[model samples]
Target chain A: MSVQERKQRERAERERLIVATARELAEQQGWDAVTTRRLAERIEYSQPVLYSHFRGKREIIGAVALQGATELAGALRAATVTADGPRARVAALARAYLDFAARNPAVYDAIFQLDGGLAYAQEDTPEPLKGAFAALQESLGEVAGNGVHAGLFTETFWAALHGLATLTRARRLPPEYIEQRVELLVDRLALV
Target chain B: MSVQERKQRERAERERLIVATARELAEQQGWDAVTTRRLAERIEYSQPVLYSHFRGKREIIGAVALQGATELAGALRAATVTADGPRARVAALARAYLDFAARNPAVYDAIFQLDGGLAYAQEDTPEPLKGAFAALQESLGEVAGNGVHAGLFTETFWAALHGLATLTRARRLPPEYIEQRVELLVDRLALV
Candidate 1:
């Protein structure tokens, strides 16, 4: 490889480190605690180095949100693709989506709650987000029922999963009822 | 009225004022700006007086959450009770839930997101919260489908409304799709 290509590779690696560090910091401490100074210190880089990579905290959050979206898309795909039937796939999708939210709350917050300087539900939306939704739609389309738009069906079902995740994470919904809630959702909403 | 009765009424009024002031402050500048010092000043009450009414910030948030719950319950009931059919009632309920979240974001956050020190989904959960769920259940119970548990069904539907509210609020979903999303949810999920 050329010398310039080697330098580009190193820069890409640095960017990943920065995003991963930001996500780890955010999860360990809430977003409020993730100042640029703290992030720079933890990553063993000078403030200027970190600034050169990300404009500030918002950009860092956006990077994390993107990575999280990709991870969520992968998790959902893995959960649904192997399921035997349409009903089983929808149930698997719901559980996987909620589990992603519960496991990576800080990342979830970045994607759903905090300002990540990202455009959504638009042609210019980040690839990872669109991918995440597409993963859900792939499985949900089969059970969308006749005459219903598959995208709309996916949006509604995704919202239900989002609700379950956020509410469950907040402890507003009791944990014991999680399974029953999933069952009720699939039994009533999924045409299969 | 006797002086004791008058004092009791005055105290209740003062508590209401505190909650309202906090809600207004939170709405205008977000929750972080609604500090105790700012709250005491807004209510024209001494810090000690504010303390006498409630323990601290957590209690104040709890008070706001309870008030919001009561208000949401009223709104949902008013929207659904007069709708012409089960499908219409469910759609109206979804609209009302999203509208409540959009109109009173701070209050909605207190009830759903922020640490309000409120019990939920348990036998000892607070009254206003229980009432709010029942308000949703009243309409949702009609369209829960045969052999499905009403409470679980309501929980799932409520989660969908919540997901739509939060996601729409965050602009993760485009605004133009709002009505279509609601229509799809009602048509596909409701047994009607």
Candidate 2:
């Protein structure tokens, strides 16, 4: 209720607007087209204001990546919760993961492909990144098979899903039979 | 050889030199550092000379991708030929594939990550790309399991390997336990 607290809230809102605009611009015209100047222009703020919110584009990318990771975690959890069994849950997780990649490719690239200047799989990794991994682990660890480390199994399975999403997007793999590929991946990799 | 034959040979040699120079520069200083002007200077040729061999950077990437594919095919075949059984051969193939990606990061990017003006998984795909896929298929198709199409199985397996290669390189995954991951992938995915 204090004046300073209201100002802080406004600052946070402006930061969100900047990130949303950047994501929208990137989605419309790939990451290369995203520049601080253009982002400032689109948000109707001075470059200084944009800089105050983010050090530069790398930081912006990191912000987007964090947001994407959080969304990805939610999407994966949602997909799995609706499925009936372990196998179905795993399959749903894969579908949701791929669908996310296909639909929001720029955001996916920010999280995985581009240099978002974010640490990963380490003690100091950001909470959103860790949360995304934990989401996968929750569904996949149950089916990690006997004697396989759940974390390792989740990493391997995640890598496979990442590959499918990437190759399909890159046109390295044909789009046809994607469903079959997912079924085969789940049927073979999951212990259940 | 006749004068005409000698001229043809010399032209082919220059083309090779251009491709090699571009690849070397890319490997040393990521692909972003590669440009027609830099490439011409490195090869001791003019920009026009470089252009004569390929239309532009995209075509140059295609050439590198083709070269990488040929090398990858050879590496995979070599690794599997010495292995004892289907399971061992598949493991060897996975290791060799990953090794190739690690050793030739830029070339690997050219083949998979960069826009190389290349057609993939299509009838009109370049010969070297097809050869590389065929090499993987040779070892993997045998263990595709009953009632599974060999090509589909090979594609799925290839995507998993790709995910591992890409994520490991990007530092998204921890470096340790790669060998175990490979073993788990082969054991679980292959019917062997």
Candidate 3:
């Protein structure tokens, strides 16, 4: 490969490294603790180098959100694919979603809560966000009738899942009954 | 009233004025703009006076959250009281919730997203928070079976509603379909 191509690849790798480091810092000590200077210190890079990769903390959050969206899509697809029936698939999907939120609270907050400056539900929305929505639409299509818009159903189902995940994380709900709640949601949405 | 008692009451009234001013500023310009100094300037009071009312911005947030919680409980009760059937009541409650979030984004954020140092789920939780939960549980009790725990069902249903509100505010879902989505959730959850 040419020298220029190799240098470009290296730059991309460094960008990914910065994002990974920021995500880890956020996960370890909530997003409030992840400062640019601390991120630079942890990655053993100058603050300027970090800024070269990201405009600011908000951009870094957007990068982490994109990474999270990709992971969430993969988990949703896996949950739906391995399940046996329509109701089972929906149940598994709900469980997988809640598990993801619990395991990655910071990343979830980045995507949903923080003002990451990422455009959502617009023409300029990122590919990862679209891909995540597609994954949900595909999974819900299994149970959604042909005349119904799968995208719409997916959005509604996703709203329910988000509610469960956020409320549970906030400790507004008892954690022990989460499984039963997911079961009820799946049975209710899928059976009818 | 005696002069000393009147003076004490005036001081308490000033504190309420400060909190109310801060809340209005947050609602108009978003939470990022509601700084202590700005609040002092808006209320025409000294910074020290503002500090006396609230230790800092966090305490102001707590006050706002409490107010929002009270408003939320009232809205839920109003919706619950007007509806006839379990399904209709649930749907109305969901609509009221989403509308409240949409109308009061900053207050909603203070109650749900920000770390305002308010206790949740414990017996020591603030009265407004507990009262809000009680209102939801009371409405949910109509649909939950006789043997089932109303609190658990309320939590699950609340989770779904919270998800819808947060996602809709974040633009993760289309605004036009919010009513249909709430209907779907109510129907699914209310069905025996």
Best by lDDT: 2
lDDT of 1 by residue, A1-192 (tens): 699999999999998998988899989997888988898898888888888988778888999999999999999999988999999999998888888898899999998888889999899998998999999999999999998888888888888888988998888887777888887777767898
User: What lDDT does the true structure give each of the candidates?
Assistant: 0.89, 0.95, 0.84
Greater-lDDT candidate between 2 and 3: 2
Indicate the fraction of true inter-chain contacts that candidate 2 also forms: 0.78
Candidate 1 residue lDDT tens string, B1-192 = 699999999999999999889999999998999988889999898788888998889999999999999999999999988999998899999999989999999999999988888889889999999999999999999998888888878888898889999888889877777888888778767898
Candidate 1's docking class is: medium
Off by over 4 Å in 1: A1-12, A32-37, A45-49, B1-14, B44-52
Give interface RMSD (Å), model 3. Answer: 1.4
* Higher-scoring candidate on DockQ, 1 or 3: 3
Candidate 2 per-residue lDDT over residues B140-184, each given as its tens digit: 998999999999999999999999999999999998999999999
Taking all chains together, each candidate's TM-score versus the true structure is 0.88, 0.95, 0.94
Give the TM-score (vs. native) of candidate 1: 0.88
Off by over 4 Å in 3: A145-147
Q: What is the DockQ of each candidate?
A: 0.71, 0.85, 0.73
Best candidate, TM-score: 2
Q: Write the per-residue lDDT of candidate 2 for residues A21-101, one digit (tens) a residue.
A: 999999999998998889999999888998888888899999999999999999999999999999889999999999999
